[model samples]
Each structure stands twice: as C-alpha cells, then as structure tokens.
Target: MNSTRRDFTELTMMSKEKWNDEELFYFQHALSQLLQYVNPEGLSILHEINREMHSRD
Candidate 1:
C-alpha cells in the first residue's frame, strides 16, 4: 500500500478499539462527504475505511 493508505490504516487500527457506534456513524458520514471532493486516491482510502468499518459489524 502507499503511504497514505498505510498511514490511514495504522491510524484506524490504533483507534479501532475506542470507536463507539455513534462515532463510527459520524466517521462514515464524514468520509462520504469527503469523497465528493477528493481525488481517486482519496476515494480508495475512503472505500477501504468503509469496508473495514462494515466488516466489524
């Protein structure tokens, strides 16, 4: 993975245990908003985050 994805994944893992349902929901919503304005690389990161979050459900 690129540095962006690697850094994001690391951050997510570090915070994973601390996220409550509401926080996760808010994060997803924020990512969705960001997606609208980001480039393809950013979109990929958002998608990865979404997939990771969903897999936790």
Candidate 2:
C-alpha cells in the first residue's frame, strides 16, 4: 500500500486509463464492498476506480 500522497498519486496516475472493462468491473465491485469499512485512502482509490469506470460511458 502507498504510505504517502505522492506515492498514491503516482500509483493512481500509472493505473489510470489502463483498466480494461473486466478489471474495472472487478475493482468497482471490490471497492463497493470495501466502501463501508474503507479508510480515507481506500475511499480515494475507490473514487478513482469509479471515475475510470464512468469515463468509459
């Protein structure tokens, strides 16, 4: 897991625009399950995944 904002940003940027449909669907489902218990960082990751998913629309 990324310990700092910079690393998290780097990871997010690296992963953005890279998820295929199946991967995005998997992440969306997994993150939705984590939504109830996720920390703020997890929320951010989930948000990014959702953003990518929506971008496909």
Candidate 3:
C-alpha cells in the first residue's frame, strides 16, 4: 500500500482499540478531510511518520 494508506491503516487499527465504532468512524472521516489541505511541511511530517511506522512493521 502507499505510505499514506498504510499510515492511515495503522492509525485505524490503533484507534479501533481505543475508540468506539462511531467515534472511530468520525475521527477517520475528519482526518481524511483535513489531509486534503495539508501543507507541504505537514505532508512531509506525515511521510516521516509513515516511514517510522513502516520501519516498525
């Protein structure tokens, strides 16, 4: 999967354990919308986090 998708998958997995189904759904939906306008710096940060998460896997 792409890094972004992978990172999101990892996040969803973690959130599933911590949040109720409805809460998790809204959290992911909000994040998905927020990501659409992320600045270059923010995108880089997310890429870095994705890399870190991938390395752990």
User: Could you say which candidate leads in TM-score?
Assistant: 2
The candidate, 2 or 3, that scores higher on lDDT is 2
Question: Which candidate leads the pack in lDDT?
Answer: 2
Worst 10 contiguous positions by lDDT, candidate 1? 1-10
How much does candidate 2 score in TM-score? 0.67
Candidate 1 on 1-57: residue-level lDDT in tens? 223233344556655445555555655687788767877866765676576678787
Model 2 weakest lDDT span, ten residues long: 1-10
Candidate 1: misplaced stretches above 4 Å? 1-26
RMSD of each: 8.4, 7.0, 10.4
Candidate 1: C-alpha lDDT: 0.61
Off by over 4 Å in 3: 1-33
